[model samples]
Target: MRLTTIGFDADDTLWQNEQFFRVTEERFADLLTDYAESKHLKQRLLEAEMRNLKLYGFGIKGFTLSMIETALDVTAGKVPTSTIATIMEIGRELLQHPIEPLAHAAETLETLSGRYRLVLVTKGDLFDQERKLAQSGLGDFFDGVEIVSDKTVETYVRVFNRHGDGPDKSMMVGNSLKSDVIPAIRAGGWGVFVPHALTWAFEREEPPVNEPRFREVPDLGALATVLAEIEST
Candidate 1:
Protein backbone atom coordinates (compact mmCIF):
# COMPACT_ATOMS: atom_id res chain seq x y z
CA MET A 1 0.00 0.00 0.00
CA ARG A 2 1.12 3.56 -0.66
CA LEU A 3 2.36 5.43 2.39
CA THR A 4 -0.25 7.90 3.62
CA THR A 5 1.37 9.61 6.60
CA ILE A 6 4.93 10.62 7.53
CA GLY A 7 6.31 11.69 10.92
CA PHE A 8 9.45 13.79 11.39
CA ASP A 9 11.64 14.54 14.39
CA ALA A 10 12.42 18.16 15.06
CA ASP A 11 15.51 19.70 16.76
CA ASP A 12 18.65 18.34 15.11
CA THR A 13 16.41 16.55 12.64
CA LEU A 14 14.98 19.70 11.06
CA TRP A 15 17.33 22.42 12.30
CA GLN A 16 20.51 23.00 14.30
CA ASN A 17 19.76 22.22 17.97
CA GLU A 18 22.69 20.26 19.44
CA GLN A 19 25.27 22.50 17.74
CA PHE A 20 24.01 25.42 19.81
CA PHE A 21 24.12 23.30 22.94
CA ARG A 22 27.62 22.07 22.09
CA VAL A 23 28.97 25.56 21.56
CA THR A 24 27.55 26.69 24.88
CA GLU A 25 28.85 23.58 26.61
CA GLU A 26 32.37 24.21 25.28
CA ARG A 27 32.26 27.71 26.68
CA PHE A 28 30.90 26.23 29.89
CA ALA A 29 33.79 23.77 30.00
CA ASP A 30 36.30 26.55 29.44
CA LEU A 31 34.96 28.67 32.28
CA LEU A 32 34.54 25.79 34.75
CA THR A 33 37.75 24.00 33.84
CA ASP A 34 39.57 25.73 36.66
CA TYR A 35 37.07 24.52 39.25
CA ALA A 36 36.32 21.15 37.62
CA GLU A 37 37.11 19.25 34.47
CA SER A 38 34.63 19.33 31.55
CA LYS A 39 33.77 15.70 32.12
CA HIS A 40 33.00 16.29 35.80
CA LEU A 41 31.04 19.47 35.10
CA LYS A 42 28.92 17.76 32.43
CA GLN A 43 28.13 14.80 34.69
CA ARG A 44 27.09 17.08 37.51
CA LEU A 45 25.00 19.15 35.14
CA LEU A 46 23.25 16.00 33.89
CA GLU A 47 22.43 15.05 37.48
CA ALA A 48 21.09 18.53 38.16
CA GLU A 49 18.92 18.40 35.05
CA MET A 50 17.52 15.05 36.13
CA ARG A 51 16.58 16.72 39.39
CA ASN A 52 15.15 19.78 37.61
CA LEU A 53 13.05 18.11 34.86
CA LYS A 54 9.81 18.95 36.63
CA LEU A 55 11.02 22.38 37.72
CA TYR A 56 12.49 23.70 34.46
CA GLY A 57 11.24 21.25 31.80
CA PHE A 58 13.74 21.39 28.88
CA GLY A 59 15.65 23.86 26.69
CA ILE A 60 19.27 24.91 26.16
CA LYS A 61 18.66 28.16 28.02
CA GLY A 62 17.45 26.58 31.27
CA PHE A 63 19.90 23.67 31.03
CA THR A 64 22.89 26.00 30.57
CA LEU A 65 21.80 28.16 33.47
CA SER A 66 21.44 25.08 35.65
CA MET A 67 24.94 23.96 34.67
CA ILE A 68 26.34 27.33 35.69
CA GLU A 69 24.45 27.25 38.96
CA THR A 70 25.70 23.74 39.71
CA ALA A 71 29.30 24.66 38.92
CA LEU A 72 29.28 27.62 41.31
CA ASP A 73 27.68 25.56 44.03
CA VAL A 74 30.04 22.67 43.40
CA THR A 75 33.18 24.75 43.91
CA ALA A 76 32.06 26.75 46.97
CA GLY A 77 32.67 30.32 45.74
CA LYS A 78 35.70 29.42 43.61
CA VAL A 79 33.87 29.60 40.24
CA PRO A 80 34.47 33.39 40.35
CA THR A 81 32.43 36.40 39.18
CA SER A 82 34.27 36.57 35.84
CA THR A 83 33.55 32.92 35.06
CA ILE A 84 29.89 33.52 35.85
CA ALA A 85 29.82 36.42 33.42
CA THR A 86 31.44 34.24 30.74
CA ILE A 87 28.95 31.47 31.29
CA MET A 88 26.01 33.86 30.99
CA GLU A 89 27.54 35.31 27.85
CA ILE A 90 27.74 31.84 26.36
CA GLY A 91 24.10 31.25 27.24
CA ARG A 92 23.18 34.49 25.53
CA GLU A 93 25.05 33.40 22.45
CA LEU A 94 23.15 30.15 22.54
CA LEU A 95 19.77 31.87 22.70
CA GLN A 96 20.88 34.02 19.79
CA HIS A 97 21.79 31.00 17.69
CA PRO A 98 20.20 31.44 14.25
CA ILE A 99 17.92 28.46 13.64
CA GLU A 100 19.49 27.09 10.50
CA PRO A 101 17.40 24.52 8.70
CA LEU A 102 18.97 21.23 7.78
CA ALA A 103 19.99 20.74 4.12
CA HIS A 104 17.00 20.56 1.77
CA ALA A 105 14.66 20.44 4.74
CA ALA A 106 12.40 23.23 3.59
CA GLU A 107 12.32 22.04 0.00
CA THR A 108 11.69 18.47 0.98
CA LEU A 109 8.89 19.37 3.35
CA GLU A 110 7.18 21.43 0.66
CA THR A 111 7.54 18.66 -1.87
CA LEU A 112 6.29 15.92 0.39
CA SER A 113 3.38 17.95 1.74
CA GLY A 114 1.82 17.78 -1.70
CA ARG A 115 1.64 13.99 -1.57
CA TYR A 116 1.63 12.72 2.00
CA ARG A 117 0.34 13.63 5.44
CA LEU A 118 3.40 14.83 7.39
CA VAL A 119 3.42 15.23 11.14
CA LEU A 120 6.33 16.59 13.18
CA VAL A 121 6.89 14.41 16.28
CA THR A 122 9.47 16.06 18.47
CA LYS A 123 10.31 15.81 22.17
CA GLY A 124 11.55 18.89 23.99
CA ASP A 125 10.53 22.17 25.62
CA LEU A 126 7.10 23.16 24.35
CA PHE A 127 7.99 26.82 23.93
CA ASP A 128 11.22 26.07 22.12
CA GLN A 129 9.73 23.70 19.53
CA GLU A 130 6.81 26.01 18.88
CA ARG A 131 9.19 28.91 18.35
CA LYS A 132 11.31 26.80 16.01
CA LEU A 133 8.34 25.78 13.86
CA ALA A 134 7.25 29.41 13.61
CA GLN A 135 10.74 30.43 12.59
CA SER A 136 11.36 27.67 10.03
CA GLY A 137 8.02 28.30 8.29
CA LEU A 138 7.80 24.54 7.84
CA GLY A 139 5.00 24.36 10.38
CA ASP A 140 2.40 24.57 7.63
CA PHE A 141 3.88 21.54 5.94
CA PHE A 142 2.88 19.16 8.68
CA ASP A 143 -0.68 17.90 9.00
CA GLY A 144 -0.07 18.02 12.77
CA VAL A 145 2.69 18.46 15.32
CA GLU A 146 3.26 16.20 18.32
CA ILE A 147 5.43 17.98 20.91
CA VAL A 148 5.92 14.93 23.03
CA SER A 149 7.32 15.14 26.54
CA ASP A 150 9.12 11.91 25.80
CA LYS A 151 9.52 9.59 22.82
CA THR A 152 8.82 5.96 23.67
CA VAL A 153 7.31 2.90 22.03
CA GLU A 154 3.93 3.57 23.57
CA THR A 155 3.95 7.20 22.45
CA TYR A 156 4.79 6.15 18.91
CA VAL A 157 1.97 3.66 18.82
CA ARG A 158 -0.51 6.21 20.07
CA VAL A 159 0.67 8.98 17.73
CA PHE A 160 0.84 6.76 14.68
CA ASN A 161 -2.64 5.41 15.17
CA ARG A 162 -4.04 8.82 16.03
CA HIS A 163 -2.49 10.68 13.09
CA GLY A 164 -1.84 8.18 10.35
CA ASP A 165 -4.15 5.65 8.75
CA GLY A 166 -2.26 3.10 10.88
CA PRO A 167 1.28 2.18 11.93
CA ASP A 168 1.75 0.12 8.79
CA LYS A 169 1.12 3.19 6.62
CA SER A 170 3.01 5.77 8.72
CA MET A 171 6.72 6.49 8.33
CA MET A 172 8.94 8.13 10.98
CA VAL A 173 12.03 10.09 9.95
CA GLY A 174 14.62 11.76 12.15
CA ASN A 175 18.24 11.91 13.30
CA SER A 176 18.04 10.12 16.63
CA LEU A 177 17.95 6.35 16.66
CA LYS A 178 16.45 6.14 20.12
CA SER A 179 13.96 9.00 20.01
CA ASP A 180 12.77 8.72 16.42
CA VAL A 181 13.51 5.53 14.56
CA ILE A 182 13.56 2.67 17.04
CA PRO A 183 10.41 3.55 18.95
CA ALA A 184 8.32 3.99 15.81
CA ILE A 185 9.76 0.88 14.15
CA ARG A 186 9.13 -1.21 17.22
CA ALA A 187 5.59 0.13 17.23
CA GLY A 188 5.18 -1.43 13.76
CA GLY A 189 5.63 1.78 11.78
CA TRP A 190 8.13 2.31 8.96
CA GLY A 191 11.20 4.26 10.13
CA VAL A 192 13.98 6.14 8.39
CA PHE A 193 17.10 7.26 10.19
CA VAL A 194 18.23 10.58 8.71
CA PRO A 195 21.61 11.13 10.30
CA HIS A 196 23.10 14.51 11.09
CA ALA A 197 26.83 15.09 11.55
CA LEU A 198 26.31 16.79 14.91
CA THR A 199 23.76 14.61 16.71
CA TRP A 200 23.29 15.29 20.43
CA ALA A 201 25.33 12.97 22.67
CA PHE A 202 22.21 11.75 24.40
CA GLU A 203 20.34 11.39 21.08
CA ARG A 204 23.17 9.41 19.44
CA GLU A 205 22.40 5.70 19.18
CA GLU A 206 22.92 2.74 16.82
CA PRO A 207 20.19 0.93 14.91
CA PRO A 208 19.94 -2.80 14.27
CA VAL A 209 22.75 -3.44 11.79
CA ASN A 210 20.82 -5.72 9.48
CA GLU A 211 17.18 -4.71 9.51
CA PRO A 212 16.00 -4.86 5.90
CA ARG A 213 13.15 -2.47 6.59
CA PHE A 214 15.21 0.15 8.46
CA ARG A 215 16.87 2.79 6.27
CA GLU A 216 19.49 5.45 6.94
CA VAL A 217 19.13 8.41 4.62
CA PRO A 218 21.49 11.37 4.31
CA ASP A 219 19.02 14.27 4.48
CA LEU A 220 15.38 15.36 4.22
CA GLY A 221 15.54 16.11 0.48
CA ALA A 222 16.30 12.47 -0.16
CA LEU A 223 13.31 11.66 2.02
CA ALA A 224 10.91 12.69 -0.72
CA THR A 225 12.59 10.25 -3.07
CA VAL A 226 12.34 7.51 -0.49
CA LEU A 227 8.66 8.12 0.03
CA ALA A 228 8.04 8.02 -3.69
CA GLU A 229 9.65 4.61 -3.92
CA ILE A 230 7.64 3.32 -0.97
CA GLU A 231 4.44 4.60 -2.48
CA SER A 232 5.31 2.87 -5.75
CA THR A 233 6.11 -0.43 -4.09
Candidate 2:
Protein backbone atom coordinates (compact mmCIF):
# COMPACT_ATOMS: atom_id res chain seq x y z
CA MET A 1 0.00 0.00 0.00
CA ARG A 2 1.52 3.31 -1.01
CA LEU A 3 0.63 5.65 1.84
CA THR A 4 -0.38 8.82 0.01
CA THR A 5 -1.78 10.93 2.83
CA ILE A 6 -0.56 10.49 6.40
CA GLY A 7 -2.50 12.24 9.15
CA PHE A 8 -1.16 12.92 12.65
CA ASP A 9 -2.71 14.05 15.91
CA ALA A 10 -0.85 16.91 17.54
CA ASP A 11 -1.27 16.90 21.32
CA ASP A 12 0.31 14.05 23.23
CA THR A 13 1.12 12.46 19.89
CA LEU A 14 3.58 15.06 18.61
CA TRP A 15 4.31 17.38 21.54
CA GLN A 16 3.69 17.78 25.25
CA ASN A 17 0.12 19.06 25.76
CA GLU A 18 -1.76 17.34 28.60
CA GLN A 19 1.12 18.10 30.94
CA PHE A 20 0.42 21.79 30.55
CA PHE A 21 -3.29 21.20 31.17
CA ARG A 22 -2.46 19.15 34.26
CA VAL A 23 -0.30 21.93 35.66
CA THR A 24 -3.02 24.45 34.97
CA GLU A 25 -5.63 22.23 36.60
CA GLU A 26 -3.52 21.92 39.73
CA ARG A 27 -3.33 25.67 39.94
CA PHE A 28 -7.04 25.96 39.31
CA ALA A 29 -7.74 23.53 42.11
CA ASP A 30 -5.73 25.61 44.50
CA LEU A 31 -7.66 28.71 43.61
CA LEU A 32 -11.09 27.17 44.17
CA THR A 33 -10.28 24.88 47.07
CA ASP A 34 -11.92 27.29 49.48
CA TYR A 35 -15.20 27.38 47.55
CA ALA A 36 -15.71 23.75 46.52
CA GLU A 37 -13.91 20.45 46.92
CA SER A 38 -11.30 19.66 44.30
CA LYS A 39 -13.26 16.68 42.99
CA HIS A 40 -16.45 18.71 42.71
CA LEU A 41 -14.62 21.49 40.94
CA LYS A 42 -13.14 19.03 38.46
CA GLN A 43 -16.51 17.44 37.73
CA ARG A 44 -18.20 20.79 37.37
CA LEU A 45 -15.50 21.99 35.02
CA LEU A 46 -15.96 18.95 32.78
CA GLU A 47 -19.71 19.45 32.71
CA ALA A 48 -19.24 23.12 31.98
CA GLU A 49 -16.84 22.42 29.12
CA MET A 50 -19.20 19.92 27.54
CA ARG A 51 -21.93 22.51 27.88
CA ASN A 52 -19.75 25.37 26.65
CA LEU A 53 -18.42 23.37 23.71
CA LYS A 54 -21.74 24.14 22.03
CA LEU A 55 -21.29 27.88 22.46
CA TYR A 56 -17.56 28.58 22.38
CA GLY A 57 -16.53 25.57 20.26
CA PHE A 58 -13.09 24.56 21.62
CA GLY A 59 -9.90 26.25 22.91
CA ILE A 60 -7.90 26.65 26.12
CA LYS A 61 -8.48 30.39 26.48
CA GLY A 62 -12.25 30.06 26.37
CA PHE A 63 -12.26 27.00 28.62
CA THR A 64 -10.02 28.70 31.17
CA LEU A 65 -12.19 31.79 31.28
CA SER A 66 -15.32 29.66 31.61
CA MET A 67 -13.84 27.84 34.57
CA ILE A 68 -13.07 31.15 36.24
CA GLU A 69 -16.53 32.38 35.52
CA THR A 70 -18.01 29.25 37.02
CA ALA A 71 -15.84 29.71 40.07
CA LEU A 72 -16.98 33.29 40.49
CA ASP A 73 -20.64 32.35 40.19
CA VAL A 74 -20.38 29.31 42.43
CA THR A 75 -18.41 31.11 45.12
CA ALA A 76 -20.02 34.52 44.82
CA GLY A 77 -16.94 36.66 45.67
CA LYS A 78 -15.53 34.24 48.20
CA VAL A 79 -12.66 33.21 45.85
CA PRO A 80 -10.93 36.57 46.18
CA THR A 81 -10.08 38.78 43.20
CA SER A 82 -6.43 37.76 43.59
CA THR A 83 -7.29 34.14 42.85
CA ILE A 84 -8.94 35.22 39.63
CA ALA A 85 -5.81 37.18 38.77
CA THR A 86 -3.73 34.11 39.49
CA ILE A 87 -5.90 32.03 37.17
CA MET A 88 -5.45 34.64 34.45
CA GLU A 89 -1.69 34.42 34.91
CA ILE A 90 -1.88 30.66 34.61
CA GLY A 91 -3.88 31.04 31.41
CA ARG A 92 -1.10 33.25 30.01
CA GLU A 93 1.47 30.65 31.00
CA LEU A 94 -0.54 27.94 29.19
CA LEU A 95 -0.65 30.17 26.11
CA GLN A 96 3.14 30.45 26.29
CA HIS A 97 3.64 26.82 27.28
CA PRO A 98 6.90 25.23 26.20
CA ILE A 99 6.39 23.19 23.02
CA GLU A 100 8.98 20.46 22.80
CA PRO A 101 8.05 17.51 20.61
CA LEU A 102 8.24 13.85 21.58
CA ALA A 103 11.53 11.87 21.68
CA HIS A 104 11.71 11.22 17.94
CA ALA A 105 9.22 13.83 16.68
CA ALA A 106 11.63 15.95 14.67
CA GLU A 107 13.74 13.08 13.32
CA THR A 108 10.62 11.08 12.47
CA LEU A 109 9.08 14.02 10.62
CA GLU A 110 12.37 14.65 8.93
CA THR A 111 12.41 11.05 7.73
CA LEU A 112 8.80 10.95 6.51
CA SER A 113 8.07 14.44 5.17
CA GLY A 114 9.40 13.75 1.69
CA ARG A 115 8.10 10.20 1.65
CA TYR A 116 4.44 10.94 2.35
CA ARG A 117 1.71 13.58 2.10
CA LEU A 118 1.73 14.75 5.72
CA VAL A 119 -1.24 16.52 7.26
CA LEU A 120 -1.72 17.54 10.89
CA VAL A 121 -5.25 16.37 11.71
CA THR A 122 -5.40 17.65 15.26
CA LYS A 123 -8.32 18.91 17.37
CA GLY A 124 -8.02 21.69 19.92
CA ASP A 125 -8.35 25.37 20.63
CA LEU A 126 -7.32 26.98 17.35
CA PHE A 127 -5.20 29.62 19.05
CA ASP A 128 -3.44 27.05 21.24
CA GLN A 129 -2.68 24.83 18.27
CA GLU A 130 -1.35 27.76 16.22
CA ARG A 131 0.97 28.69 19.08
CA LYS A 132 2.25 25.14 19.49
CA LEU A 133 2.76 24.68 15.76
CA ALA A 134 4.65 27.97 15.48
CA GLN A 135 6.88 27.06 18.43
CA SER A 136 7.56 23.33 17.82
CA GLY A 137 9.51 23.81 14.55
CA LEU A 138 7.61 20.79 13.16
CA GLY A 139 4.69 22.75 11.69
CA ASP A 140 6.28 23.06 8.27
CA PHE A 141 6.41 19.28 7.98
CA PHE A 142 2.67 19.09 7.34
CA ASP A 143 1.17 19.84 3.91
CA GLY A 144 -1.91 21.14 5.77
CA VAL A 145 -2.99 21.81 9.35
CA GLU A 146 -6.54 20.90 10.46
CA ILE A 147 -7.72 22.70 13.55
CA VAL A 148 -10.94 20.85 14.10
CA SER A 149 -13.66 21.38 16.71
CA ASP A 150 -14.03 17.65 17.19
CA LYS A 151 -12.69 14.51 15.54
CA THR A 152 -15.85 12.65 14.64
CA VAL A 153 -16.83 10.39 11.73
CA GLU A 154 -17.41 13.47 9.57
CA THR A 155 -14.05 14.95 10.40
CA TYR A 156 -12.26 11.86 9.14
CA VAL A 157 -14.50 11.71 6.07
CA ARG A 158 -13.65 15.32 5.24
CA VAL A 159 -9.95 14.66 5.68
CA PHE A 160 -9.97 11.65 3.36
CA ASN A 161 -11.98 13.57 0.76
CA ARG A 162 -9.81 16.67 1.03
CA HIS A 163 -6.79 14.50 0.36
CA GLY A 164 -8.61 12.90 -2.60
CA ASP A 165 -10.40 10.09 -0.70
CA GLY A 166 -8.07 7.13 -1.05
CA PRO A 167 -8.98 5.80 2.38
CA ASP A 168 -7.22 2.46 2.03
CA LYS A 169 -4.05 4.26 0.96
CA SER A 170 -4.14 6.64 3.94
CA MET A 171 -3.48 6.16 7.65
CA MET A 172 -3.87 8.17 10.85
CA VAL A 173 -1.33 7.98 13.69
CA GLY A 174 -2.15 9.38 17.07
CA ASN A 175 -2.42 8.70 20.84
CA SER A 176 -6.05 9.26 21.64
CA LEU A 177 -8.34 6.40 20.69
CA LYS A 178 -11.53 8.46 20.88
CA SER A 179 -10.34 11.35 18.73
CA ASP A 180 -7.73 9.63 16.61
CA VAL A 181 -8.44 5.94 16.16
CA ILE A 182 -12.14 5.17 15.83
CA PRO A 183 -13.00 8.04 13.51
CA ALA A 184 -10.28 7.19 11.03
CA ILE A 185 -11.39 3.57 10.95
CA ARG A 186 -15.00 4.64 10.54
CA ALA A 187 -13.94 6.59 7.47
CA GLY A 188 -12.42 3.38 6.00
CA GLY A 189 -8.84 4.48 6.69
CA TRP A 190 -6.21 2.70 8.73
CA GLY A 191 -5.68 3.87 12.31
CA VAL A 192 -2.57 3.46 14.45
CA PHE A 193 -3.08 3.78 18.19
CA VAL A 194 0.03 5.13 19.92
CA PRO A 195 -0.43 5.00 23.66
CA HIS A 196 1.09 7.92 25.56
CA ALA A 197 2.71 6.70 28.78
CA LEU A 198 1.05 9.43 30.84
CA THR A 199 -1.91 10.86 28.98
CA TRP A 200 -4.32 13.26 30.59
CA ALA A 201 -7.10 11.35 32.33
CA PHE A 202 -9.69 12.46 29.81
CA GLU A 203 -7.63 11.33 26.82
CA ARG A 204 -6.36 8.16 28.45
CA GLU A 205 -9.52 6.12 28.89
CA GLU A 206 -11.19 4.68 25.74
CA PRO A 207 -12.88 1.45 24.74
CA PRO A 208 -11.06 -0.72 22.19
CA VAL A 209 -14.24 -2.14 20.55
CA ASN A 210 -12.24 -4.57 18.36
CA GLU A 211 -11.55 -2.46 15.31
CA PRO A 212 -9.68 -4.73 12.82
CA ARG A 213 -7.71 -2.15 10.86
CA PHE A 214 -6.31 -0.61 14.03
CA ARG A 215 -2.78 -1.27 15.29
CA GLU A 216 -1.23 -0.33 18.65
CA VAL A 217 2.22 0.99 19.58
CA PRO A 218 3.88 2.53 22.58
CA ASP A 219 4.38 6.01 21.12
CA LEU A 220 5.25 8.12 18.08
CA GLY A 221 8.74 6.70 17.67
CA ALA A 222 7.21 3.26 17.45
CA LEU A 223 4.68 4.65 14.98
CA ALA A 224 7.48 5.59 12.60
CA THR A 225 8.66 1.99 12.69
CA VAL A 226 5.16 0.71 12.01
CA LEU A 227 4.69 3.05 9.03
CA ALA A 228 8.03 2.01 7.58
CA GLU A 229 6.95 -1.63 7.77
CA ILE A 230 3.60 -0.79 6.20
CA GLU A 231 5.43 0.92 3.38
CA SER A 232 7.70 -2.09 2.91
CA THR A 233 4.65 -4.36 2.51
1-233: candidate 1 lDDT, tens digit per residue: 77788899988888988877876777777777777788887788777877776677667666866877787777886777777777777776666677789888888888888688889998777877788889887888999999987888898888888888888788899989988888888888888998888865566677855764588788877886777777777
Clashing pairs in 2: 59-125
Write down the RMSD of candidate 1 (Cα, Å).
2.4
For candidate 2, the lDDT comes to: 0.80
How does each model score on TM-score? 0.87, 0.90
Q: Model 2: which ten-residue window has the lowest total lDDT?
A: 200-209
The TM-score between candidate 2 and the true structure equals 0.90
**Full-model lDDT, candidate 1:** 0.80
lDDT of 2 by residue, 19-118 (tens): 7777787788778777888888877777777777777876687778777877876697577888888888888888888997888888878888878888
Runs of candidate 1 with Cα error greater than 4 angstroms are 43-57, 73-78, 81-89
Colliding pairs, model 1: none
